[model samples]
Target: MIRLMFLLPILLCLGWYYFLRVNGVPLKQGKRGFIYILAFSTLVLGFFVLMMHLTNPG
Candidate 1:
């Protein structure tokens, strides 16, 4: 779970990077859209951590 959790962000970043590059949204992701992404990042990371800890309580 830890292994996959880490990879997911990397994949999401790559996908976002490519999407921005193709759309010319700049590397910063624009100020207005940042908040939405920040929230999403928090949710995704939080969920991953929670799930991992819950499933592997060793």
Candidate 2:
């Protein structure tokens, strides 16, 4: 479970990267790309935080 908490976000990001490439999104060259990267980063960070909170005792 602990390992999964770290792996899940990486897997999800890879999937998302594949999806973007399949659609030919310019991942390296524009404002749109930056937005997508920013959003995904935020999502991954939030997921990790949530997992940590769930696994830790107060």
Q: Write the per-residue lDDT of candidate 1 for residues 1-58, one digit (tens) a residue.
A: 5556566556666776778888889876454454565567778889877887899959
RMSD of 1: 3.3
Q: Estimate each model's TM-score.
A: 0.52, 0.49
lDDT of 2 by residue, 1-58 (tens): 5446556556666776787788887656444644666677678778878988998988
The candidate maximizing lDDT is 1
Please report, in order, the local distance difference test score of every candidate based on alpha carbons: 0.70, 0.67
Task: List CA RMSD, all candidates.
Answer: 3.3, 4.3
Q: How many pairs in model 2 have backbone atoms within 3 A of each other, for residues 3 or more apart or on separate chains, i.e. clashes?
A: 0
Model 1 CA deviation exceeding 4 Å by range? 31-45, 48-58
Evaluated against the true structure, the overall lDDT of model 1 is 0.70
